[model samples]
Target: MPFFDHVGPEPDDYDTSPKQDVRLTQLGSASTKTSFTCGDAFGWANRTPGVPDLDSRVALDTSTDLASIPPFLWGLIASYGRHTMPAILHDVRCDASKAAAGNGGRARTAYLRRHADHQFRHTLKAHADQGVVTRYIMWCAVRLFGFRPLGVAVLAGIIVSMLHQSSNVFVSVSDLLNKVTIWPWLSWLDWVPQGIAWGLAQLATALRPNQPYTGIMIAVATISLVALVYRSFERPAAGGPVRFSLPALLSLVGAGVVGVLTAPPVLPLVVVTMVTRFVLWLLDFVMHWLDLAWTKVLRLIDGATPSNVTVPEGAMLPAAVPPFPGFFPTP
Candidate 1:
């Protein structure tokens, strides 16, 4: 039997169609939503063995972020995209499980959390137009952070480690800032953040059992590459976030998984990619600023009307201020 039994033909995979109107609205910055009732009932029952089933419908008032995807990850899998419908169904079912577990004690809560996460995975498989690799990765992320205090802490540490390692990118940004004559203090302070990040990584390592900094670093690199690979397959945006053709998305995601599992030496490659992007970004920033400054100089010269020309009667004159703003001073 199929894993999920829906009430009717499954809802559209995405809301990009003119005819499809998504009913959920974001509630502030958090990935959550205001409660709203559904016009038609959407139901799902698990037929897969060993997996818990909700055995209920989802027509009632629902509040969800559509997906629990973090903001930083929106570029890869947006909170609302092809998987929007499945996420909604999963959210509703997870809520039901949470309510049931409230009175069932800690063990029951843990059990239900697993059930909820598994159901989420199954729903994604059944409804989302996503590859198995993508769906499984998302499910694993959910499962990892579903364990409450410990899981949340670990995830948070991993994020900190990733940011810490990526701090080297900003060293070039600092140098460029110094050269642009913006803020000298910011230029030498790049090491401050790097130092702080190192300290935090140490703290996180101390808290973990095995102090897995190397593993965390490798994981971060792998995830970064996977995101890039998936992003490479993204289709141009029509009205919503960019999406992937099923075939290309599936292929990229599968390749990403295989690469991560088979090739453990990806840290250096990701490091190179990161450094190259940073340097390119710095160059672009410098060029844009130089272009803007040159344009401003030309505008001033153009507006000056040669000193040899007589001013028109009652014509407005230039303000008594520095001609180049921050780069110069008026006497």
Candidate 2:
């Protein structure tokens, strides 16, 4: 932050007295609604209250006072020469927000400055968000790599082995529970959740724990990559900006190549898992996206004025008076 020298109107700096504080407050509110930011120049008034400076100048017309601005601010003004000297100032923020949200999708800009500075900001922000997500996913995969998958496999395998041994005399877990009300052992098979667990263990070990935890990890990684690709095709919007990212693509390709190298024994299970997840997620996002259609419908119903859609170049935002009535001299 560059140091600013010009202090704003103090108690004795301008004719305004106690009302100087009140007027400053009003100017700040005006800045929020429009870009003619007079209040921003005198921000010290709010942060530090004292006598008004003897040599304070609050010029709302940024284009005219180029020489009076400090060196750093002058450099900024020089860099934006065209806008700095414009006869009227266009509010860049209002244009950007409306266009990106699709509310003013019909409006298109031909001006270079307006297009790059305002219209392009949203696209840049989206790309930044995608980068953060890609990093997070890769970080999680790396940190959880060695032991976590093995632990999950060991737990799953033990349950499978126990279920197989216990069902020897009985036909199923339900039958075992009925015949042997043997406290802890039988009680484990009593509930719906326990029954689901028994079913999963049976599937995982149908071929037996002769296959180790590494195999389970390979199968899971394969399934996840397959689901990601399927989901890419299944819901293009949901794939997001990350889908096209080089790092994201490379990480995915690497996972798939390793899965093929291992040739895990559970290809059938992996396919089923990937396909089921894609289908459910596809149905879900479709329902949510359907709601967004109404905004377009409402805009159409109300009827759009093509004239109101575009912001003209060198347009000054309306000069709203400070809210403190009678604070200024009558022209």
Candidate 3:
């Protein structure tokens, strides 16, 4: 017979002798009666047929028998214990009376409301801080410069921002190509447009004839103002409102005044700025193509075979040899 079958449903069946009849309780109920026999009580009866003792095998209650739980369920319980239990216990303690009175639902709702309010306050404060910092930086840069200074600064800022945006697009495209294309080989394709733009700017500067420096400064300033006004009116989502620093504003005015006094021309500067921006757009286009290639490669790879295949050509292997010839001599 199974060991469990021999263990009777009463404490006395397993215990060879009994003395006290203490009432057992669960969940604060005195009327509840537990029917399971203790394992140690039964073992004791077998060891000493006439003497009553606690059964070792059945002494532990089923609800607390952690070993009886399935492995997955045990892991879930353990994870909850480590992460969720503390928060749950805190909440329970805060509303212990309500929970005990069977209003656990209301207690949980209250806890959630408090958590949300705390999170909202934190988020709002962070956003406000960021806004203040951004505005202050913009004011300092745009308001300080005069006409010429402002123009030059704006030109540099626009180019830098465009380049930053283009690089992000390029990286995303490259990642996609690597995923979709089979042994895709065009990682360098994205740089071609940027190179062309740089070459164009150099050529324009070299070809331009010497003129009044003042004239050239004026041209650049005019173009910058136009760009600024256009950006503000169009309100493009990709690049939002343009902000100039104070130093830049002051520099622009100073340059314009100097140019008017000296009568020097600076048209070539405007040309160069325009050419640089055109190059950035070309770079963006190349990046888009790379993204398309990457997406295609990923789809193809996904359709072909299980990712864990062991072909020698595609399988990963240890490096064959170092590319460098030898270690350098210490200086």
Candidate 4:
């Protein structure tokens, strides 16, 4: 039997169904206002060829509803979340294989994998060749000090050199003052003792695991001491007779006083000064060595001849060089 034959002609008249009754309820009325939809929120109708329209529906088609907004709206949302939204979104959409292919990815990946495997094998062989104990020691050194242990060693040398130079200067000055009869009590003389003490304390602090303040003080003091030293030792060039420039001297003194006053403590101040001097000296040495090495290396690599490297024939040497004697073979 057909299902339709079992039912009545009229749906409302069917005996198996409830009686049809029509009723209407009036809803609270709201004032309607016409407004244009934001144009940016819709897809772009016109765009330059080869240029993706940010307003296009395709650009808005993101996996997440949050991301499926118009590009400008998405940018606003993303900016509010921090500019990381673009990167996060890119990551979400990223197919590593596709990305790699864009930049010769296959070749790069193969190269990296090959290099990594070779490195692993080399490391294993190195360990085996060195024996387990030797390898362990090497590993510990690398882990503790890193690949450039020479940097720390260089710093240590600089510190030592600075200490030596300062000590010599202080001793020499003190001896010179003792020999002189007049003007014995100079405030400037106190700088040496204060500076030395400060340097030692700073060094101690830097070596100490728990004391960070020592290092801080050392840095502050060192700066002041260098200024003081420069003012004390600065001299004019040969043609310009040596004379103390009051302005320079006043500036140095002012800076030193301010540094000492604002410094954390006396000990740190001295240490900092000493360390700074050492650093400066080290830097000067490094620069000098680099200059020499660079010149030598360039000459060697560029295949420059010694004759060509000589001072130009017409160029006069500095007056500092001693004059050579004239030929005197007489009959």
lDDT of 3 by residue, 131-235 (tens): 433223222222222122443545444443333434444333433333332123544443443444455444334334334333544565677666433322211
TM-score of each: 0.44, 0.19, 0.19, 0.17
Looking at model 1, residue 140 earns an lDDT score of 56
State the lDDT at 273 in candidate 3.
34
Clash pairs detected, candidate 4:
198-270, 198-271, 199-270, 199-271, 217-268, 218-272, 221-269, 221-273, 222-272, 222-273
Off by over 4 Å in 4: 1-267, 306-308, 313-331
Best by lDDT: 1
Q: State each model's CA lDDT, in order.
A: 0.47, 0.31, 0.32, 0.32
Q: Considering summed lDDT, which 10 consecutive residues are worst modelled in model 1?
A: 322-331
Per-residue CA lDDT of candidate 4, range 1-331, in tens? 0000112333222123211221122233232211111111111112211221221121212322211211222222221122122211222223232344335433332222222222222342332243444233222222212212321332343453343434444433433332331134544344444554555545544444434544544654575445333433322332233344554445334433333233223323333344334434444555666766666676677788645776658864322222222111110
In order of TM-score, best first, we have 1, 3, 2, 4
Better of 2 and 4 by TM-score: 2
TM-score of 1: 0.44
- Candidate 3: worst 10 consecutive residues by lDDT? 322-331
Which candidate order results from sorting by lDDT in descending order?
1, 3, 4, 2
Error of 1 at 76 (Å): 0.8
List candidate 1 segments past 4 Å from native: 1-22, 25-39, 46-56, 156-331
